[model samples]
Target: MNIALPALVVFALLLPGFIARSRIKRAERSSLDYSPFGQIVTEAVLWAGGLHLLWLALAALFFGRHVQPTLLLGLMVSDAAAQARSISNLASELSWIAAYFGSLFAFAYGAPALIRAAIIRWRLDRAGAPLSPLLRFHAAPWYYLLTGADFPPGEEPDCIVVSAIVNISGRPWIYMGILDDFFLDPEGRLDRMVLEKVMRRPLDADKQPSTQADEELARFYVVDGDYFVLRYAETVTLNVEYIKLRPAA
Candidate 1:
């Protein structure tokens, strides 16, 4: 390993990932802290996989190596071994710095939006209409994290409808909400404690119900779109609860 060359290669290899990891950490510190090992494992796996692909591609392109039948598998094993050693060393020496940068970057990019979404969700909860767990919220003109499926059109909605007006620069652009796949238990049942009502309304679409009762249901609102619109689509469900956030007051 040429000292300078390896150092440069390592920097090139790890700098961007480190920056990205930091950004995610800072932005979602609470979430990240609660879920560091999980996140790190996920990132490590993804990094390992991606690097394996890159290694193969480079070998094929530059070294003219035949992509054998077991090339991918071989790459994965080798990459894993390499990463295990590197991570252990880095954990001892550079883990703190790596974690610091990762957190800073994550906060810079991720925190604002998460904070906005939490506010929106809080407002929606206040308005008595909470969004279902499946719903997503975006940061921007609409600070809420309602589901993307709710708004078919790519228009950004208003956040103030649900909470106090917070000034955000730039035109309100739209992005998909963060997906929490762990919304439901393994048995496909909801945790009642975590579930709260944002908005409640009658289910009037299906009138021919003889067995199951047709009682009114509550659709939890997250943030409001342009003040507040309680219109519910068939596919969208409503439920509400405040996401725990310790944002700067």
Candidate 2:
């Protein structure tokens, strides 16, 4: 049908870009709000057109398959009748077209990830590094915030110590622990954090933690769980200490 032809042409143009975007998302570890929908569509169109043009150019040079621009343009504007007339030729070369698109899809999935890996290996994602303006070590801020990736390589923290104040039972409570893991909400905000060896005490129940409190750590009771989950929304205040531990003999 006339309607289906245009749709297929659009699909043929956009599908490879979507494939590449999906791979890039994984490579970059992006959050859900990576880009606006309009920007995504615009980038997809650009990616497809550029990749197709380059592919056609290489094909002409290497395989003598000099695809005409009008061939693609005609497909975009073709009706059911025109497609029917060209059906036999298309069917004859269907396998070659399939192979060609298959290779392009593979390239789409691979090239972005390869580039990202190279950038990371060369430290090009760091601030003041080459291409740092365009490429980052990660698309998620959580990675840098939680892991201290911006720190010098050998000095990066081995652990995160978290202290949080939360009002849950009509009174504020203070909790402290080593951060084990964290989760993100659909909108890419902090959802909850998981803690190990968690300890807690009611606010105003004790003096602030310090060398003085080191003598009275018994004031804080252990949370009897392998991991404690703290919802970010319930927290009134949060503090984190990035700690680097020396190897024990």
Candidate 3:
């Protein structure tokens, strides 16, 4: 038996699980303490096995047929038996094959997002948000930290605002704005951030003493564009404020 045939067979089965794991990680931050690749591989294998088991169950239940074990074992060592059975399966029930593959694609991309939404809706992600800790949500600490959504019902902030001091050249610049968005690198560290309704000024602008007469003097000028992009690496200091807006009467 050629080593390449078995290698290919293993890859084919694991592809969908790899994609699914990637989607899950990409959709949220991963905070694993150990090596994530090993975890991914173990998870991928389990997920692939579960999916295959379910697929086989569905095939037998609805189509009244099953993949021949001879064909499964044969696939690892050579193409002949596997190809022959696969062709017969394809010809006899192309719809089932199509549905099965389509499901793999959906499982890869859609399941993570759907699962997150379900967790949030049931208040499972925030550990029974606004109430008590029924279960803990261990994903996306940045999201939880920024929005304060995990707070009790009315106490949670409606918006999170950020004031940042960024060092530029030899001087420091100050920026104030509503948090527009934030991005994380592959290592799960903050990379950069975007702010809307931004205003900027030199940090030295506030150095002088302020009196009631000087209050009218604006210290910050409105930034010209829609968003102010700041590299987190350049940030000297950051302050976050939670703003709560009263509902309209």
Q: Highest lDDT among the candidates is held by which one?
A: 2
Give the TM-score comparing model 2 with the true structure, all chains together: 0.76
Q: Which residue segments of model 3 deviate by more than 4 Å?
A: 27-35, 77-102, 120-123, 127-141, 147-156, 168-173, 184-189, 199-226, 247-249
Candidate 3 global lDDT: 0.70
How accurate locally, in lDDT, is each candidate?
0.36, 0.75, 0.70
Task: Spell out the clash pairs found in candidate 3.
Answer: none
Per-model C-alpha RMSD = 18.0, 3.9, 5.4
Candidate 3, RMSD to the unseen true structure: 5.4
Clashes of each: 34, 0, 0
Candidate 3, run of 10 with poorest lDDT: 130-139
lDDT, candidate 1, residue 18? 47
Question: What is the per-residue lDDT of model 1 for residues 123-211, given as tens digits with 9 covering 90 to 100?
Answer: 43222235533222221111233322233232323221111111224322111122232132233233211111223223432244444
User: Cα deviation in Å at residue 24, candidate 1?
Assistant: 6.0
**Which residue segments of model 1 deviate by more than 4 Å?**
1-26, 30-32, 36-39, 62-143, 146-150, 163-249
Error of 2 at 58 (Å): 5.4
**Least accurate 10 contiguous residues by lDDT in model 2:** 24-33
TM-score of each: 0.26, 0.76, 0.66
lDDT of 1: 0.36
